[model samples]
Target: MSGWQRVLRGMLDILYPPPPLCALCERPLRHFLQGRGAVEEPSLLCVACEKQFAFIAGEICHVCGRPWIGESCGDCLRRKERDFLFSRSAVRYNDKMKELLARYKYRGDRKLAEVMAFFLQQAWRLHYAEMKVDCLTYIPLHEARLFERTFNQAEEMACLLGKRVGVPVYGMLERRKATEKQSKKDRAGRLHALENVFSYAPCGKYDLPERPVIVLVDDVYTTGTTVAEAGRAIRTGISGAQIYGLTVAR
Candidate 1:
């Protein structure tokens, strides 16, 4: 950047200083740093707050990638045929994860995108990186919902993960309308409500990548209906493509 631009940015920073504390605990990050070497790293939460994030570590379902007692989960078997090859979540959607999602998705903390994306990346590395995902995409929000939320949290995290992992993020799927809020419904209700709620043209020149595998990113995975519908839409539109789902939590 030019010197004038630098000077202007400095002046602007003086006029509107950014927060230097953790998003959740509101503690200054410097207090948690281990040493001078740690000062250069960026973090949304302090060490204590970060520790509260419960990561999934043991044998998981071969399909949904959720913690399971056996080799495969009954939910996956019941579904039998699914749109995506598989899905994985970084952490169990416990109380801490809920708070993180609430702050980022409901409270409009855009800066939290970095932290969430980092967690998703960790999940991918642990489970799905071997899939050789050619492209990264997100479950798009409906126009009305997008307008109401002012941003798509999934897209933000997808873009960040794509940049970090050197994959290209694409707008491959679009929601048809503002369907009933999934949170308000049960699993069956959510599945019924999500049917045909996304539109995609897999054959479109801009839709398909040279590589066939794609990873779908989202903030959370609940009933698996939304991503399954998205994957179905992609497969219906494009032939011989593989789909995978990644999320910060399940």
Candidate 2:
């Protein structure tokens, strides 16, 4: 943030202070209430709530980003083809993460988008900081689903991440048709159902980068079927593009 932005933020804080209670646990933040230390950005989570995150670290699969002893996980090893170059996730899809995502995606708790985007930013820094990311795009929701949900969680996180990372966010693909929820299906079922569901449909206003390195953003990475199909659609539009998947959880 710039100096003037900081000044403006401070002014805003004085007029409208952040909530004293943690967003999840609703415990009062002693530090904020006491006003003892220099405040950073208004925190949505308490230290305890933050500790619940199971961040992905240490050795991981080169292809899938799953915690593994070997370079590649068995699933990736057995896969005949993958559209995207590779994929990385910020955290494990544990019980806490599941609940958090449910609140955001299902309950329409938009405030949690910041928390999800923060993890995506961290994942980018940890894994793709050195890479040349031309732009960021997201797995698009179908029109019907988008209307029903009011907003796309993946798109929200991608936009927030784009602002923080100085990368442009684009709508490079769209769902051709809506299918049944992937959660109900097994890996093979998901793969078969998602086939040819995504289609490249870049926005007319923005110019496409030549042979770009595109990062596909999403809330979760399960069987890798979703992003793989989306990447394939992107390839159909931009043949030379190198695609990578980044999700909040795997």
Candidate 3:
């Protein structure tokens, strides 16, 4: 951001202060500001609400990153082939996370994108800190769905995470067609529906490195079908590409 941009943002902040209540529970926060003359950082969730989040920890599946006692999850074990190198997520998709995602994704509560991006950042630090990441891309929405939603939640969160990690984000993949919502589908149905749904279409402005390492960002990883198909599309376009998946929830 430029100096004038900062000045403009400060002016706007003073003119229109943020709400005093938490986003989730609407509880009043005790310390909402960083300090005097600093930007007021509104808390997304209160202490009690934050405690309800289930961060993924302990042993996890090597391929799918799901919390598991064994080396690989049942989903991975049953699968014959995998496209992405691996996948990892920050939190378990519990009731609290599902509610939060619904508000952010379907209800257009965009402020929650920051919180979701923070979760992605934490997942990156934990899982991909040492990995070579040439660029970050997101699971793109079809134009129809994008128009309906007014924004791609995955793209928004990916941009925020890229800024924090100092990586360049690009629209390297495109959704070929709109399909039925994956949430309602079984794993086999999801995989079948997602076939040929994605195609590689890199941004023209930037040239990706040879044999690039790309991370696919999304809001959630349920059956892993979405990211897997996306990875396959990318591989078709860029041979020897190393693809990985990073999502807010699993």
- Higher-TM-score candidate among 1 and 3? 3
Q: Using TM-score as the measure, which candidate wins?
A: 2
Runs of candidate 2 with Cα error greater than 4 angstroms are: 1-23, 26-44
| TM-score of every candidate relative to the true structure | 0.82, 0.85, 0.84
RMSD of each: 5.6, 6.6, 6.5
lDDT of 2: 0.87
| lDDT at residue 109 of model 1 (Cα atoms) | 88
- Model 3: ten consecutive residues of lowest lDDT: 33-42
The local lDDT score (0 to 100) that residue 181 gets in candidate 1 is: 64
lDDT of 3 by residue, 1-250 (tens): 8999999999998998755776666777656533111223344566677678887867899998999998998889998887898999988899989998999999999989888987787788778878879999999999999999999999999999999889989888899999998889877898899998999998776677888999999989988888889999999989988999999999
lDDT of each: 0.81, 0.87, 0.86
Q: Which candidate gets the maximum lDDT versus the true structure?
A: 2
| TM-score of candidate 2 on Cα atoms, chains taken together | 0.85
Q: Per-residue lDDT for 1-250 in model 1, tens only?
A: 8999999999998998755888767777765433112123365678888789877868889888899888778888888567887888888899988887999998898888888887887787777656677788899988988898999999899999998778888788888878976789888888889999998943245645553898899888887888889998887766676988999998
